[model samples]
Target: MGARRGFQEAVLAIVKKIPPGKTLSYKDVAGRAGNPHAYRAVGSILNRYDAKKWHIPCHRVVRSDLPAPRPGLYFVYAVLCGNGAIYIGQTGNLQKRWMQHRNGTASDYTRRYGARQLFHYEQHGSREEAVQREKWLKTGFGRKWLKREWKAGRTRQAGGTPGGYRWGSKRKLHLLKKEGAL
Candidate 1:
């Protein structure tokens, strides 16, 4: 937490400040960390971030040249597991990935927490865009966006619970919103 002077510490601290659905290029993070020319160093520092720790959303750091994703080939998807968990993922081959999830071979998280129903999916321009979008969908902003979509009737399902991260089914979410309980 004391990264006021240490470059590595500063880089991480700055990265932790990046909001969900928002991003900063590697170079931008380096500059903010007090070293204008250490973009590579920022990447390396982020590489060391422990996945076990919180407040480090390193995936939000994008390449300097990318102006965000464009629009087509790849996909970003969300699945509603039986336990009320929403899993977000990206894939170039949507059908293949769907098969994997169905067979419980996609991820341990999905296998253990979800029955694997395709609740939402969106198109992206490339693999990079899919990856970034997957990360975004795991954030609060993405959830709210989905909620808005539900409200607009473009979608009928979503994820979130009152007391914990695990939410109920699509029907439950809809009822909660209707009764103004959510």
Candidate 2:
């Protein structure tokens, strides 16, 4: 437990050094945390930490490449608009991006439609991959897949702001597979 706590502190310290709008790869974070080969463990530490409680910027840690192979870094996300439309996007930082949408800084479309809930999302390896996936999700076939796969009733309520929704385990795993995110 002492060793785990030490690693957590090291990870948190490194994460806090990441500036807003900037990011570090999990491997990079692990190296800085004094264990060059602990990239996966670094990711686990970040995932387990409560960013809200500690003011740690876990979102700043991404995969070394675009569209990460695992499902813990960058993402392609779908937001349910108040007008019943779905908005697709990609981001290295999910929490920050959601905040931007809620605050009207993300896009004109989201501002106009009003983001009501988080409908779907898939993790990617890197920013480039996430961008590509976001493009696909905006296409007709992708839209059809989303409509068929997404259960509107299962979407977590947004409550008029970002940061209110947490991903349910089953839905998250299902989306990862359906979107070829693995």
Worst 10 contiguous positions by lDDT, candidate 1: 158-167
- TM-score between model 1 and native: 0.43
Cα distance off (Å), candidate 2, residue 134: 1.1
Give Cα distance to truth, residue 175, candidate 1, Å.
Answer: 27
Give one digit per residue, the lDDT tens place, for model 2 in 65-150: 22223454787888877689998888777655765665456899877766655656677777888888889889999898888777
- Candidate 1, residue 60: Cα displacement in angstroms equals 39
Error of 2 at 169 (Å): 22
- Which candidate gets the maximum TM-score versus the true structure? 2
Q: Flag clash pairs in model 1.
A: 72-124, 72-125, 81-114, 82-115
Give the TM-score of each candidate: 0.43, 0.46
Show model 1 residue runs off by greater than 4 Å: 1-72, 156-182
Q: What is the lDDT, from 0 to 100, of the residue 120 in candidate 1?
A: 66
Cα lDDT of model 1 by residue, 1-182, tens digit: 45534988788788888654344557668888888788887767776666337557665555433123334588777777757666778877654565456445679976565333565667777788878878877789988886567458685232222211122245434433343222
Error of 2 at 7 (Å): 28
